[model samples]
Target: MRATVIHAPGDIRVEDAPEPKIVNPTDAIIRTVATCVCGSDLWPYRGLEPVGDPHPMGHEYVGIVEEVGSEVSNVKPGQFVVGSFATSDNTCANCRKGWQSSCLNREFMSTCQAEYVRIPNAHGTLVATDEHPSDELVPSLLAVSDVMGTGWYAALAAEVKPGSTAVVVGDGAVGLCGVIAAKELGAERIIAMSRHESRQKLALEFGATDIVSERGEDGIARIKDLTGGIGADSVLECVGTSQSMSQALHSARPGGNVGFVGVPHEVAVDGQELFFSQVGLRGGPAPVRRYLPDLIDRVLSGHINPGKVFDLTLPLEQVAEGYKAMDERRAIKTLLTP
Candidate 1:
């Protein structure tokens, strides 16, 4: 099997790798049908996140189950399934509470950008569709694995409500998906902060009612101006930078809420600013498993096209180009077919 290995920042290669097999009764091995590069992957690729050793790269995946372990009964071979970025045992207390990302037996699903990958907690992490999905539905279903799910979490954490003015910071795939999420949540007005023409257009299509191309304080003022100086009722911070974080905090109305979903890098918030701002903050890795069922239904029903975020697609062998396209801002997200 061939898989992507990150040797160092800006150094990635596709090379022969060992095949994966079920090592535990709770595990399953799946042949990759589709996978993609994530925004978070760039953290290690850009050298911002430490990478002391070469390792497998990628997490988001959708594939057909080739085999399951002795204990995996809910999902069997030949079923098409979507998986969360993290694994979890469904029986855990946190899993019961809808935080499968923080399950007691949780494990990160790395080494999936390959021809074959092993899945732990198979029954808990994999969501099989009602039937095999068509080729057209693969991309959308794949989105459920991470970006779409994370965007939905951002909206949920921000407390978006009917008739609420919601502001989204960032124009990446997740931010655009946030626009879709805010719309689905019944937000009356969706403001997307984006300067890129392509992303701004997608934001509008995803239900954004306004676009703010400013940054920092200027962006905050624009959000306030759009909301009649009271700021938005809810703000979704999709970029984990310090500037974007501050923008999200300041874009919310006093007593409003801000949900940040970006993989934070060098982010430090001022205690005084948060204290006086009176804005609630909540976010972490998205519990994608909790929302997978509903999101899968939406995609299967053709009610949403969140997969449009993938402006580029490549063969699994060209995974390096997929990463470059996303890092260079040439593509919003890149999808890979094995």
Candidate 2:
């Protein structure tokens, strides 16, 4: 099978690779139908994160079950399924507490930008649709696998409440989905911080009531000005940069919360500042498995179209261009079909 491999920073290639097999009884092998380039993937691509030896890339995927291990029962061959970037055994203590992303038996997916993928903890991680969805719903279903799920977790972590003011600090795919999540969760006023015209338009279409194009202290001031000098009730930190994190932390009102979902890169928080600000912070990998069933339903029901975040689509073999487009900010996200 063909898969994406990163030989080094600024170097992405599609090469032939061995197909994955079930290494554990709880594993299942699926033929990937749709996958995509995630914002996190750019970390190593841009040299922000080290790329040691060459390895397969990608994680977000929606696929058709090709085979199942003996222990796998929830999904079987011929079924369409969506799984999280972080696979979990869902039966673990953390999973029982709704934190599947931190399950005792967890595996992070890293080779999904291929024709096939081996799913760990299949019974607990893969959510099967009732029937095969139409072609049009595939992109949205694929989005539910990661970006949308992450965005939803961001909103939940920030404690977005009905009629409350919410701020999203990012314009990427996940941040755009965060806007959708905030709206669905009843945030009456959604402020999306973006400088890109396309992303700002999408954010508005996704239910952003205001747009703040400023950065640094100016952005925080704009948030405060819009919130009547109190800041927002909740802030979603979708970009993992030091500046974005600080913006999110300062954009929230005292006693409010900031849900940070971006994979932190050189980000540090001042404990003294946090203490004085009295803002809550909660974040990490999203428990996408916990929200998969509902998100899948929402996609099928046409309630949300997070798939719109994918402004570019390419064949699986053109994966390198997908990475390039996203890295250059020419595309918000790239959809890859195998």
Q: Global lDDT of each model?
A: 0.93, 0.96
- Tens-digit lDDT string for candidate 2 (61-124): 9999999999999999999999999999999999999999999999999999999999999999
| Residue-level lDDT tens digits of model 1 in 1-338 | 99999999999899999899889999999999999999989999998999889999999899999999999998989999999998988789999999999999999988888989999999899999989999998999998899999999999999999999999999999999999999999999999999999999999999999999999888888888899998999999999998889889999999999999997788998899899999999989999999999999999999988999999999999999999999999999999988
How many Å off is the CA of 328 in candidate 1? 0.7
Which of the numbered candidates is closest to the native, going by highest lDDT?
2
Per-residue error at 228 for model 1, in Å? 1.7
lDDT of 2 at 177: 98
> Which residue pairs collide, candidate 2?
none
- In model 2, which regions exceed 4 Å deviation? none
Evaluated at residue 47, the lDDT of candidate 2 is: 96
Candidate with top TM-score is 2
